[model samples]
Target: MSLTIHWTDHLTGIMRRAADPPRLLVACDFDGTLAPIVPTPAEAALLPGMEEVLRSLSTAPGVHLAFVSGRPLEDLKKRVPIAAAGFIGSHGLEMQGHVLDGVPGAAAAWRGRSPFIADAIRRRTEQLPGVFVEEKPLSVAVHYRHACSADAAAVQALLQDTVNGAREFRLQEGHMVTELLPAIGCDKGTALCALADRLGVPRSAVICCGDDLTDETMFTGLPNALSIHIGPGPTAAACRADSPADLLQLLQHVDAARRKNLRKGSCGS
Candidate 1:
């Protein structure tokens, strides 16, 4: 079945149904959300106990948890050994158990074609100096913060030119980095929607949290769910959580709330 969400207004009705609080399908993005934004993408790691908290939530009754990330599935597994919980990797390009409607079934096939691009970008930038490329399994990120202002500009121009003719991929700009990834229909938003559908939960029962441009994609078509913006953003449903630790604290609160509600339901029953 194909499912797509397009608004938070649908949440009001679900919130009403959830006055008794419905079962929740909670999802979050890694990197800027579950881990801090480090200087290099490779250096980005989850805060201590972050994975444990996710595991706890995944096991908690009334709560369903998933790690939705831009990083590849293998990389996420290596970094966050979440067992039995849902994993949505590669900016929703890939998922465990199910594939999203708009995403190509053979999408990962393109993963290998990008290293050549990464090497070329790296070789060119190495000469101009300071700029560097951090290659991931499914994508490559060009970072310029360590480069001199002039060198960074030169590298950016080269990147823009390199990506101009490629229809198979495009660039994703984030804090001091530009990532080259396959151009496709998958994104965090679609991934979350797909997960919620697979879990058989109403959109209102979903809560999504994140802290970057890639995360903003989850907000695009979210209906019947809390679209939480972690740091200050131009949206109304925003909540400010200063760091990854803060995000973990917030998840703890949600877990507690779900457990309490479940216990109450059990007692009343």
Candidate 2:
């Protein structure tokens, strides 16, 4: 939708044209994108070398990095270990630019309300074996990974009932998890656009990466940018990476390419 994609070893070809002052915004999802998907949310950590890779990108001249995740902003900041990278959590609700938030998706405005919903969900599902409800400041993820099939199904039904209409909340599904998010229209896609706009970066300079359905919104959101899908699955992303290691390699390519471009510019000057 913004720019065409060409691939060889990585996005090197595209990076080259973004210029020495790339003004690129590199945004990625956390779990299953930068980190291996663990059995539990609390068990998730960055893949080896990811922190360094992200840090390298964060410090690159004219390049901005961000983590646009379903987890709350506070939780993401604790895990990412980078103070420079912008964080958009709660699936685009928290830390999103005011431009997007000012729109109908001002779900960021409803942050404090989710705690009450989370408490009610905990009360309802606590007795169900292996059902865990993870609460965010602005959202709630009900993980049924360890629950029996019947119990998971029942929980799904209950969540569906809770968000049946265009109510205050909506049901968002992920791997073995169902999240209760604000019904606001914003998502990873809108959030990415807002970030780019806020940073004054063009769409052609954007790089979006993620691993699951929720990430599809971003791929669809930045159709012209370089979007990479991790793991084996059908994806709207123009490229595919095998794992977080593969992602690290790709980021390294972009990093090195940008630095090289900067050196070339310096020499020419």
Candidate 3:
């Protein structure tokens, strides 16, 4: 059974944890978490004032911010221009402008396979109306958001058939999008774990917020971390924020609490 808790009920506890560690990792998902999901991915932007909030949090002492997304790294960089924060892109297959650690030769191998799979997908779906193939560095997303019911079904069937016997790639389904990524041992959860490790912080010191099925990995993988799921549905997150607006409110509260604690520490010193 899943229980939904409000951010207010847990704010005090979170603040206490934030003060204890004197360090925190604020990791967030990009689409549907920080920005409202739009029909076109290229046009997505941070919710009003969210960029400013994130910038402030990034600069806060002992607070590190990160954007974890399924987007390609370059695309994510274009959308979120925060130089202080780290980025884990391509569903954790890519990290900090390089293929995630532990996958030494996997990056080169995936690069060779990516174009072949992308081309095969495009060839199979090019004639299907309303189907858009988005090519990433190590993956390809087949977007059916604009397709009618029949076309959408056709797109799905085509994708399933194209990768039926393929061993080099795997499929991931999201809201109106299907992604083909390299068959690897990485995901958002692993990415979060890796991030915490790299920062020399415990999972207890990390806070991760996301709004999709892909985000579930981070929530479950970092059981010790403070996990928040944006918008309702069954989730492993400790709390739920009703919408992006609620998420913003939660961030504002965290920022205020941290700053207050910092000032208090300075006074005592």
Ranked candidates, highest TM-score first: 3, 2, 1
**Judged by lDDT relative to the true structure, which candidate is superior, 2 or 3?**
3
> What does candidate 3's lDDT look like per residue over 1-269, in tens digits?
45869787888897776666777888999999999999888989999989988988877767888899999877888899898878888888777832233332575477666677778778888888888898888888999999888888988887777678777667788888988877777788988898888777789989899999999999999999999999878999998898887899888877776788777783111
Model 2 lDDT tens row, 1-269: 31223244545555564344447788899999899999899889999898998888777767788898898778888999987778888888777332323323466466577678888988988889999988777788899999999999989999998888548787788889999888778788988988888877787778898887899999999888788888776778887777888888888888777677777764111
- Residue-level lDDT of model 1, residues 138-245, one tens digit each, is 778888878888887787778788778777777777666778887777778888888888778788777787877877777766755776665654543334465677
List where candidate 2 sits over 4 angstroms from the true fold.
1-21, 96-105, 266-269
By lDDT, who's the top model here? 3
Model 2 weakest 10-residue run by lDDT: 96-105
Query: Candidate 1, clashing residue pairs?
Result: 7-223, 18-21, 203-224, 204-224
Each model's TM-score?
Answer: 0.82, 0.88, 0.91
- What's the lDDT for residue 206 in model 1? 75
Q: What overall lDDT goes with each candidate model?
A: 0.70, 0.79, 0.82
Judging by lDDT, tell me the better candidate of 1 and 2: 2
Whole-model lDDT, candidate 1? Answer: 0.70
Clashing pairs in 2: 1-223, 1-224, 2-224, 3-224
